[model samples]
Target: MEEYIVSLNDLKKSYGSKSVLDGVSLHVKKGEIIGYIGPNGAGKSTTIKIMLGIESNYQGEVKLFGQDIAEDSIEYKRKIGYVPEIADLYDNLTGFEYLTFIGELYGLTPQLADYKAKNLMELFGIGEVYHSRIASYSKGMRQKLLIISSLLHNPELLFFDEPINGLDANSVMIFKEIMTQLAAQGKTIFYSSHIMDVVEKISSRIILLNNGKIAADGTIEELKQINQEGSSLEQIFNELTGFNEHQAIGAKFVSIVEEM
Candidate 1:
């Protein structure tokens, strides 16, 4: 049998009368870079939250490293790293302080955490600002800091939700290469993003969630084969989501702007 690093079976989550995740089942094998995409409010974040063990109260099983999370969520978390879509950083803390804190939380010694934080910042070209407060950092800088923090302890399973949100082109290129290299080293990456182009380039497989369920899941080549031939990932996304109003919407918006 093939080994799976992450598995979800009949997963379901609801808030009050409305359902968010209506049975999501998936098996993520080791070293696969799975790009997760969906329209707004498609329960993408909820699915990731469940896998990270940050959200419970759902029905079904979520297994990471061949063990059900419900059985022991805390212990297994040491092997995982997550960069959420939205997170609040400690504005008063310096970059060095914050990253070391995260590393320590993941079970690294204080001395090792500090040493690694310094080297990573230097490699990322942010070593000059290591002592600067997070509040003083630009959007891209802060985003980079978060990414660094996630990898400080070198977790095997990574969940990065919109991790490249404010990254510059150069940073984005480096990150893509880093992701590929990590996968080559047997790291399992579940990356969620709305940027179709980047997703197309980096993902070994793509999973589209729509209406509280997985709409499509396959390699980019497989997705292309099933949908319109010679279509781009963005085009395929629109077709799969039944979205054809872009031209109309753009014209209407431009007309409204010119009305004044």
Candidate 2:
């Protein structure tokens, strides 16, 4: 069995009495792609932020590459590739320039960084936009740029938050393919998304968070066994997180609005 590349124990976080994460624990094996799913306020992103060292106020035991993140944050962060929900690239910079900047931030040599940036742009089918200023790029192009920036350093672990939010269908497929390929080469990936079908397709395991705590953790088949046969990913997700209740009410409200 592969060793765990990331682990959390009794993790807790709160935003001034509004508890965001409560006693969440998880383990991600090396080379495994783990999908983190939850509702809007379910603490998925909070946990990810804590792990990334973006939120120091958080209280927990988070280890990256078996090193305590709270203690060795800078060192731990160097081993991670992160793609945030929002793209914050410099609009005036070309795609290639933006990636080179990110690479430099990680202390890479200019020539090596540029070379890696060029290769990543070509690999992700974004080479055509390499010279175009980010301000002129479309949403999909920006997302592609963000992805390339996060990956330029070849980090051992990748963290993506809603990675497919603005991607086209083809781009989404490419992203999924790249993720699996990376994992096959002994990289760990942790991503958070509301899209159940994609998670079911790509993740080696899924961790469902509900109301600031972990609801379930297992493979698709293991989660499926929690309910009867033939249960879909969406069905299992709603059943475990109790999200179906709100969804049903929303559906009825939409129906009533349509009648008017």
The TM-score obtained by model 1 is 0.98
User: Candidate 1, which ten residues in sequence have the lowest lDDT sum?
Assistant: 228-237
Encode model 2's per-residue lDDT on 1-260: one tens digit a residue. Answer: 54579989889999997999989988888898998898899998888888887787877688889888867968877788999997577999998788888899898998999898888888778788888899998888888888888888889999999888888888899999999999999999998888889999999999999999898888999888877642777888878765557768999999999994
Structural RMSD, model 1: 1.0
TM-score for each model: 0.98, 0.93
Query: Candidate 1 residues 52-76, lDDT tens each?
Result: 8889899999999999999987888
Model-by-model lDDT, in order? 0.92, 0.86
Worst 10 residues of 2 by lDDT: 225-234
How many clashing residue pairs appear in each of the predictions shown? 0, 0
Off by over 4 Å in 2: 1-3, 245-260
